[model samples]
Target: MEPAADMETASASTSTSASASASASASASASASASASATAAVGAMMDGRLLQENALSWPEVQEICKELEHLYRKDAQKDAARVRALARKRKEISAACQEKKNTAQQQLNQLLGNVREWEQQSNTAKARRDELAKKLQELEALKREMVAQLERVRVDEQSSKESLERLLDTYETARQEALKFQLEHRNEIDRAKHFMSLYAAVTGIKWDFSGDSIAGEIHIPRTQEIVPFEIDSTQSNDFETANALWAKIDAAFDALDNNDEL
Candidate 1:
């Protein structure tokens, strides 16, 4: 049993190795067949004629030789032309790229300059705004002060006008009172003057007592003598009457002198 098992294992291992070897041989054979077929087709193409000679004969061998030489020359010329064209295109593309890069760089520089100029203008505008605001504030404060001063002046003017009106009223009242007092005393002054005139007239005449019978004869004095004489009636009655009349006359004279002086 151990021998049979060993024999079977060995058989299986031999079968696997043989299968791998067979696959490799088949692959090599396929490659060789493909190579041979390609070579046969090439030989057939090489044997063909691309153009005709002077005669109707095929001239396959000679035509093939001539065509091969023409194809080789044509291929070399085309290769040289393609190399020149490629070189020209490369130069053009490089130049175009360089121009684009220069234009982009110039545009970037201009944009940066413009941005800086804009920032400077903004700063100037801000400064101007601040200055204007300060000026406006000052103007507002001045206006408020002016208004306050105007109010104060108006109040002072009103007070002065009121005081002037009161003074005028007081003066008018004093004048009216003085006029009323003068009117009330005018009639009394006129009556006193009339009585004085009558008394002076009666006294100026000479006495007529001789017509009436009295126990004693009465003597008459001259006007000049009686003018300076005193009556010999009762002492109190005669003295009092004469003194009262003199006082009234003196007062009237004094009032007239005062009026003249004024």
Candidate 2:
């Protein structure tokens, strides 16, 4: 009985050990399968990284490198064209700015000339105004002088008129006196002629009157007037006195005529 029990116990133990060993081998196989799947996923990710990092295989990445190179070349050409355009635009702007500067300079010069001309014109105007002012002052002085002269002339004219009136009155009185003197002289001459006629008759002497002076000549009782004649003392005296009176009256008339002329 002891030997049979020991043999059964040993068999049971051996079966348990074989069962544990099989379970362990199944667990290790499952772990190894999961590890293999993880490795495959890591390899796919590595290939994507290689392509993204520009580490592609030669033949596979050839067309992609060519397309990238073409895009880079096109961008470089575009940048070069933009740079040239910017250079041309800069040149045109510089030229335009220079032209504008020259135009502004010319305009400034013109403005300066105009300002100078205006100043000259203003000076001339001021000079002209001063000259006119002086002329006006002179004219005012002349006007005042003319007015004073007019007043003086008016006063002189009034005085001259009064003097002329007095002179005219004196002249009228002188004319009346002259007329009276002429009438009296003629009366005296007639009376002397009558007296001479009486003397001639009484003395039996021939008497004759001749010329503007009315000279009287006496002759002795004559057979003819053409014969030589003689005047007596009385006749001579009467003739001389009459002649002298006539001469005096003539001189007075001559003086009056001279005064009228003046």
Candidate 3:
């Protein structure tokens, strides 16, 4: 009985030692598993926090947005510059067109002025031609009047020449008839001279006969002074012969007075 109790007591001590060793190994495994789970939970919490920061308030996103804004501003500035250049080019083209139009207008005005000057010159030439034509007509009329007057003067000169010739012919005929009548009456004149001589003896006067004339010497009854007298009878009328005879007697009396005074 004593041996059996001692064995049983040894067995009991071994079993307890085994049980304690197993329990210690299990406790170590549980602790290791718990540590792995805690590490996993912490890793998940950190990943969630990182996702929230990226969505709401990350510095890299803010920097990216600022860079995009800068690019947009640069593009806008380039567009504005292009627009300004286009506007400046359009303004230059319009200014060139306006200057060209002004030059064309000036040329048209000069052409119109030249045409007006030419028309004025033509009008002046026409008026001068009209005046020259009028002067020619007046000269022709005056020449015709002068020609008519010359023709009338020629006709009057011809008539006067004919009348003068007729008057000369009549004068020549009258002179010839007077000379013939004096020759035909020569005998009658001699008989008259003889009777005159007989009367002169009684009247105390001497008589002498010449061609168409008589000459005599007479004695004055109161003083016995002798006087010479002459008479011309070549005219056709008695009044002409009587006036010539009386003029001769008056001349003889004047000679007698002059002799008495001497």
Candidate 4:
């Protein structure tokens, strides 16, 4: 009996130990299952948080992230090419602008030269004009002087002509007076000669009484007249008459000579 009891007690103890061991194992399994479930839940929450933060569904996020990476690489490559192209364009524009500025400067210099040349020509033209004006003035003055001299000469010529005309008139008057004086002198000489001839005829020398009586009568008698007997001195009468006639002739000659002298 003792052996059987001991055996039973051992059996009981073994059974109890086995049951406690089974219970502990079961609690451990439950704790392990709870931990696994918590771990699963935490993993699901992390996945949801990651999906919310990325703002995409799992498959869409994966594709979008891959495409974004590819686009970024492409954009970087395009930016590099664009930068190179812009640099090249800038260089070309700079060179073109510099060339344009150089051309403009050259044109400005040429224009300045042209302006200077034009100014010089203008000055020369002005000087020539001034000289021409001076020469014209001098010519005008000379012309005026010549005109004045001509006028003076004309006046003098007119005065000389008037003086010559006056002298000619005076000469003509003197000549006319001389001619009148000569004519008067000739007339006086002719008158004296006629008087001398009449006196000589009146004083005849040989006086015949019959001829004388007949000559003195208004009507001459055709027959010869007889001498008067009372005429005692006929010869003395004739001599006296002849002497008076000679004296009258001499007196007449002297009168003619005196008239010629005067």
Model 2 ranges with Cα > 4 A deviation: 1-76, 174-262
Residues forming the 10-long window of minimal summed lDDT in candidate 4: 214-223
| Cα lDDT tens digits for candidate 2, 40-143 | 65557556858697676787556555655665566557556655655565565556555555655666677678889999999999999999999999999999
lDDT of each: 0.60, 0.63, 0.65, 0.61
lDDT of 3 by residue, 177-251 (tens): 878887889888899988877766555556666545766777665567787776655543678766665566556
Candidate 1 lDDT over 35-104, as tens digits, reads 5565565456754422323332457556665766665566557556655655565565456545555655
User: Pairs clashing in candidate 1?
Assistant: none
Q: Write the per-residue lDDT of candidate 4 for residues 1-262, one digit (tens) a residue.
A: 4444544555565555556555655655665566567557655755786777666577865665666566556655755665565556556555655655565566667778888999999999999999999999999999999999999999999999999999999999988988988797888878887875554244322233564231221111222222122122444576775565454445545555676689
Give the RMSD in angstroms, all C-alphas superposed, for model 4: 41.9
Candidate 3's displacement at residue 51, Å, is 42
Best by TM-score: 4
Please provide TM-scores, in order, for all candidate models, with all chains considered together. 0.39, 0.39, 0.37, 0.45
Candidate order by decreasing lDDT? 3, 2, 4, 1
lDDT of 2 at 189: 82
Error of 1 at 206 (Å): 43
**Candidate 4 CA-lDDT value:** 0.61
Candidate 1 achieves a global lDDT of 0.60
